[model samples]
Target: MIHDTNDAIPHQLIHDALERVISSREIVNSDRKKRFLQFIVKETLAGNADRIKAYTIAIDVFNRDSSFDPISDPVVRIEAGRLRRCLEHYYLAEGAADRLQIIIPKGSYVPQFVMREVAAPTLLRALDDDKQSTSERLPEIVPAEAEFSQAPVAATSSYQPPGTAPSRVPLLKRPRLLAGLCSLLAILTIALAGTTLFQRYQVSVSSRAVPSQVPTLMVLPFENDSSDPAQNMFAKGVTEEVIGALILFKNILVLGADTSFQFRTETALRDAVPNVPIDYVLKGSIDRTEGQIQVNAALLRAADHQYLWSGSFRKDFTSKSMLDLRRDIATQVALILVQPHGVIDKAELQNTVGRPSESLTSYECVLRTREYWRQPNAEMHKQVRTCLERAVRIDPDYADAWAALAFIYTDEARIDFNPSAERPDPTLTALEIARRAVALAPDSPLPLQALGIAHWLRREPALSIAAYEQARVLNPHDSDILADLGRAYSLTGDWEKGIPLIREAFDRNPAQPTWYRLFIALYHYVNGQYAEALAQAQKIGTPNLVYTHVVLAMIYGQTGDRDNADYEVDEILRLYPNFGDKAVFEFERRNIDPAIISRMLDGLRKAGLDMDPDREVANEKD
Candidate 1:
């Protein structure tokens, strides 16, 4: 082993060290690794660092075809990583006396040759930076400090021979003092050890215990590693793609870009996020060359800063390749989080397919519009419409955007009923857009689902059933598609078949939103399971909420529980006093089956629902 010295290392020494590593047994053992090492080093020394990229490495070193895709064929990256480990092994055992050290940091392909002492300092600083950054970012918990305030216990021994006599020695002698000091030192070390362990035990329990509910996540804005500011849009697009794909995780709640993008910096993120319990943080940087890109990401537990996963991906920089990158990364992150806990409930794990984006702007708009899903404000709804509208304007062939826009309009009709008679009907507009979506993407299942919704909303039950049945063939396990299909069957008065499919949807998605439980309640009501229907309806939150009260009132009324039904009506009236004068009854009459409408109206009438008394009487006559 070489000792530390103050003399400057020569340039020749670095080259010699590199040569030794490239020719060492570790490198020579693998044919692919030796060539990869030689190529990058030669490129770096020749001042062609920019050319030493994923595409170049794949073609020149690995003999890939001209149409080689760096995303699909990761041979170059795999070889580069292998070369790094080989160099580390060679230096540690065989080249220990070498004055210079060689290394390759992630996110770049250029080899770095430096004096041994200089390399040690940089690595030490990185460790220090990690420690400092961890404390600065996670404010709730910190490393325990060793306390030396308490005095150590005095030395004591219990041993005496039966025939032995005590020596005539004076107290506080030099020898006795030395023994006491040693004993006190040992006691102090043990005390510090125990204290630190106890503190770690407390932190471990608090931070590592997984909660009973589904995990929540927030995808923060990714940092751009490129020097050009123009690449910012690409970085943002990558972040959006990741969030969009992660939406398929039915058991996870992902925060939208609006809130996540607000915390652009680490300081802002840490300061703004402590109140909300986030289970993990997925963050990384994106670097791009002329025809290649590299992404480095780490998934860390928020509570204890434990790394669940960390990896780097280098790929060709086409938009389609980027889509593949996002899908792969999102799938890996979701599965890693769920695999250990045995919580993979949805069909997303089996469906890893993704379509290429014709226009990134349209794709970003589609991703941004999803943020307004749970939000009920008109302003948010307007934002969704504007984004999707502009998306289709920019890319007319964008099928997903058209389909999503269709769904938005259908929702506007269902949830945000307009009172102004002069405005165009939302259901009609949705039907037009849904038809356009189906025409554009005939092979895709999403447009078909949207078509089903539009047809059902337009009061064409048979057409809705046809569209839904086609969609079911394409994606049998999609919960949304199944739910829509079940609703169509209910409208057509096929309660037996519809009820099972809807129940299957709920079974496949244990952590679905509150509205899903309401759908189950509706299905159970149609199936004549009044008690189960009431129980499902009660799970929809406080009965004071309009939807919850409406579901409960109908269930209670049908079971001949008049007192409970009236109580639910009182809550509904308190929540929305104009229920009789509003569109709620109209929504039911238009969407429900004719055979079930009379029975439902009878229950509502007995519960004192004062909505359209004449219409109620007429329904009974039918």
Candidate 2:
């Protein structure tokens, strides 16, 4: 029988037994029975077999039930005590001579099963010794058979004997012990299953190890201390500058300003650090009163919540330039945060001459441009271009301002926003401005990243990769630089190298705009991996989900789903009426695969979209 334990049992039988136990009136009240049943099911499924200790099992069960109210009712501890008695009776009677024996020993949550082992002489010897000892302990005057026959018959019945208490007899008896063992094992099985099901309901739960060699830090938003509400932007600008400075280190993981700013409303530091496992946190506050500006900052250990270093600085706000003061604070903060790790030496942090200026006006313009860029519409594009132009005009030498201008122009050319205006000659303008930026600050990664983008737009994949590689060396923590490099590698048909880099960027910044997801999908689609491409496209949660639908249409067409593909094409045209041959041609010219183009065109044509003769000729030539 033990050798046949691998045989399958009917699931219906187990379910029926569980239902009967839960509904039985002889045990306890309805509510108590229900709770007990639920706990037993959860335990049997989730409790680790290797760690059978009672306390461990209690903690596991209590943690799962949010309403258990550990302070008020000790449900886990009380249930364990009752379960032990129920199990003892089941094993003694029906299971006494069975090949398989289930036992839930006292002071242990994990159940143990015993089976016949023909080869283990030591085990057999131990069992024989125990039997002899039990026989000797019994009184010699009373015969064993007579004592067995004289045992009360009430033990096997549901009703108790008159004038005798139900709890008087020991639970571990001949016929009743089998029932007790089954009860305990069944309850534990249910408990284990319930716990596993509950854990699966949580969101964003991940178990990833952080590399020991990489340094990680979180920068909190700066506090606003000025009486005038208008001065809030200045403090915000200072916070962003520190983030930008630390991002220049390749061996660091600096949380971006967009994610870090959300922590401002959190009352405690622990509340801000979610799944982002980091080594340190940097916090600061700014005060502006009576024409004076004061900034206070501190570096804290994330594990112990202790302030490792702190400092305060004061300057006359009316006389001293705000940009200069911000630059001083950014440099000081970087030095203090990285000095202990010995990653950024004192000399390197002190040499901040050629770095981008922390001008308040330029900072405001960049912030506004970022907002407009997120809209992804023609009007928003125009607004962002204007803002970026003003940022460059305000601070002509600012490297970040020049980079932003170059990025916007290249994007406009790629998207064909102004096909009638001589294409704006963006390549020439981007190349020249990017070169000037590199000349001003040769070591800074910002200029290098800009140069890489310019080369990428010019179709110089090798040069673009080299520039991005240099940028990565200067600032490994900059997700933007890594993402751009990944894109360049994909465009050059190096999908293997591109996928890992893009995935790392996604892990670091999960809430970025849809542009990253779109690129990742393109990489998969172009490689003929339709399923992977569709999966990634579905992850994108932006208003421009239309792009995902367009990709899906192409995928469906390739896979021979003509009806679904046609429906997708119709929806795209309905949403954007002007979407026509020109729109398709513009997308195709950007090195998008001709196979994808043919599929999309076939779906659109089936949906009543008129094809332009000239555009078809150009596509054929390509």
Candidate 3:
């Protein structure tokens, strides 16, 4: 017999059961019984003995919390249930012939060892009867020791009373137990408080992780400080030139003109600089007289909004020193921005100038090209090509100008605009120009990015991906590089890997193009998630997403919604009249669904537009 005597309760129960079962010697090594014993011991030591019978205890432990509620919290009820099955299994296999019996009676928590002479046949019959009745009486409680000796053969044998509780066990009195628990709780409380305070201090220190490299600066649109309104363009030109010069240095993330212009109308300095969460902002005002220009510039630390550096420059336009003065101002600003790292010497600053002239012609050309590219029509494409061509001519070795020219041609081929005006083979031309730019300066990632796009357009996806990966390694924080990488991956049908890269790029520059949304939509469409594709397409505003109409028409057609499909098809035709069978052939070559083709043709037919419906049927036949 085993009694609950704190620590001994666990050992005594197992020791007594093992001894009795071994004495029977019917089956010497029972793996199941050994496993049950080990399970009970492990549970008790783990402070989960009360939940021993619950099947979900292991799962609850794995979840690492008490989020689940069990029906019974009684330790006795749980142990009794487990013990009955354990003893039954042991008796049937290991204790068939033993006169001395071990009984873990139904619905009783503790084990009982009954020493009685009993025939094997009668005991087997009694065990069979108990098995039949036990399952139905799962909630029933049996009389403690009375049921143990009440077997038919046990009536003839002498019964021994249960043993007294063991003396070696120490009693944990209620008052002492409560006091120990309170002390433990208090210790945990103090430890947790100290740990939390330490963590908070670590976080505060880490929030300002010392920038890994030189701190960057964004020379925001300078205020026109001149009294004459006509001089405003000259002031703007000076600010733009400064931005252009600073961008040549590989160390800086000069917020481009597109981004800086967003802040032009923002009355407050804080509102204008939204996307760039930087450490500093360079604010300046340029005032000009008939023959002289005065520029006042101040660099303010973004963290505390305090001024870190300030200076003023005066130059006469007619004097030969004017160009020298502009270069001096640029050199000084670059030095101040990079000062936290180290002071840049005059010789090093002079070396940064790849082109010595302070002429605004190339700068103005870049600005015009930017505007034209934004419009992205046939005429705009031609204008951009012309501007970029002129820029390259002005500075023969300008890698940026070459890259811009390559990008214009790449865009023409990518969007299926007129390509002959730019080059007979725009994609190949773009690739050659991009490769030349990279050959000239392999460290620059911009040319490599353009090279990647050319490879993508050439249908060499794997090579494109490799080139983009190389670009990312060179400039990890470049948003344009990230976006191009995402597009390359998406085009190659690796949507899962592509979406996150695009998302990171979007987080870096939200106002760039809506290509991220378009890529996501295409991924969904190809994967047979039509509704999701439509939803993502809608998030990209309609005016900006011209290709969305084509995708929407395809999605609606495939889903068996003819009316909506025809509506989208009509809209596409209205917007782009030249969209014809070549477009359909391109769609088919890209593995667009046949049902979508039928819907597009149907919409075009209903809109009274002339199209060769036979072309789709012939492609299918071929």
Candidate 4:
């Protein structure tokens, strides 16, 4: 709904340009410059565009007090000059291909936007294709005058020679026959041309190559322009971060890993993406030379293969700079997609990403873990766990690492991955670790999220809901957190509040994950929509589905689909053969509600599932 201000760059395009500038390696590598860019743009967007001058910038962005003088101290002027040259360099360099141009004119803080022009070659090609199609369809529909023209006849003149005698002569006589014939031809020609043109328009519209829907983005793995191959991580990391950030925009559909997995090189993308209908393709590279680093990136419209925007940023290298670079790119990308209103709250970012990492290993490990966590494969989960463990060991104060570890442990119990008979109790350890994470980073939502999950596993729904609510406050836009909080609300018997939250999650993420599907299915099952719940459960196509199968089994059993229910029960038994045994029952008693336990057992009984070989089901209550 946010529109362009005045005749300036359209609101959406302006956001895309801002994203380009902020993510430019130059901005990401320099924190001060990035902050300056963000504040000035924000101010401009807020309509104080012209009013923002040296004095205000100094006082607001530079933190100069009232005692600061514009004339006496040239901090604002100097910084402004630096900012100007930086922008100029950015556009001429990294931002060269950007469709929108944002300029802070000389001697003014107000920003003006200019949209870039696409290349003529691409335009000409599109036009040629259209003409070819039209020509093919209308080859025989030539104008009637061209097809049947009357030969011109000289006007018959009755006159006498000047020297001889005068004779009756008509100086101007209308050629009635010729005029009438020409008029009739003109009318027919007009009608035929109009019909042909309309048909061309209809054909063009009907044959349009791409689908009309929400715009989609596919971010490719960035190339390493750096001399050292090890530095490729910076580019790859930035690419991953951009994907993460852009996914938050509810309006944009980001193609997840599978569809984008092969897009590693320019050649690969150019060759592969033509077959796929994508709105835009983002490609970038990281270059490091001596102490300075430069990142160059561009967005291309997939339909025409035209570059929409391109930019390069340069900055001096520092460990801290490297650490901040990836996230800054992501934040910038998101802002570009949604614009002024979509600027990620700095406080939330701080809470989620944490302050600069003291240890690179911990940071890198956590990044790798997050990558693996998205995969629905056992190998990926194993890698996720290993990475988290290594990260926490490297930096004991790494709250994100501890939070992830605890979540994984709690998840093992939920999925029966490490059932009671096969493995030692992990719920207590997971709960303790979650507590440690919350104590260490009270401001972070991730740790709070983990704390909530741990409490839920321990059957303390009140504590779980409280933790989830707080987490929601810390990160209001996060879909996963919303869904989790809603699940907690529903589990505590607040279906009215919970259902809306789940619906919001679906709205936010057009391509909801398998986990999301399971959560929604569970909510439906609890609400007694057995058929809907079964349908939702069937949509979970994750390679490592666990608890989803149980939900499916229960839904089927409740709906009297005994064969399917028994099939699911057999799968569960194979996973946890001693599910109803004494050890498992004791563990369940400590962490599960009686009502939930009874419901699960009832469904399984209906599905013809058997008690553990060594124990009677009635003894479990004791």
lDDT per model, in order? 0.58, 0.53, 0.52, 0.57
Per-residue alpha-carbon lDDT of candidate 1 for residues 501-590, written as tens digits (9 for 90 to 100): 877766654443455567678767867888888888877663334667777888887777888888889887876777765523654534
Name the lDDT of candidate 1: 0.58
- Ranking under lDDT, best-scoring first? 1, 4, 2, 3
Q: Please list the residue runs of candidate 2 whose C-alpha ends up more than 4 Å from where it truly belongs after superposition.
A: 1-360, 370-375, 417-423, 526-529, 542-549, 559-564, 571-580, 583-588, 592-622
Kindly report which residue stretches of model 4 are placed more than 4 angstroms away from their true locations once superposed. 1-361, 371-378, 416-425, 542-546, 580-599, 611-622
| Residue-level lDDT for 358 in candidate 2 | 36
**Candidate 4 TM-score, true structure as reference:** 0.42
Q: Against the hidden reference, what TM-scores do the models get?
A: 0.42, 0.41, 0.41, 0.42
Worst lDDT run of 10 residues, candidate 4, spans 142-151
Please identify model 1 stretches exceeding 4 Å from their true place. 1-379, 417-423, 526-528, 541-545, 558-567, 574-578, 581-589, 616-622
- Tens digit of per-residue lDDT, candidate 2, span 206-227: 1111122234677888888777
Error of 2 at 266 (Å): 21
Provide the lowest-lDDT 10-residue window in model 2. 201-210
Model 3 agreement with the true structure over 425-534: per-residue lDDT tens digits = 67766766665555444445666677677767765665567667766655455556777788767655566778788887776544445645777776777667878987
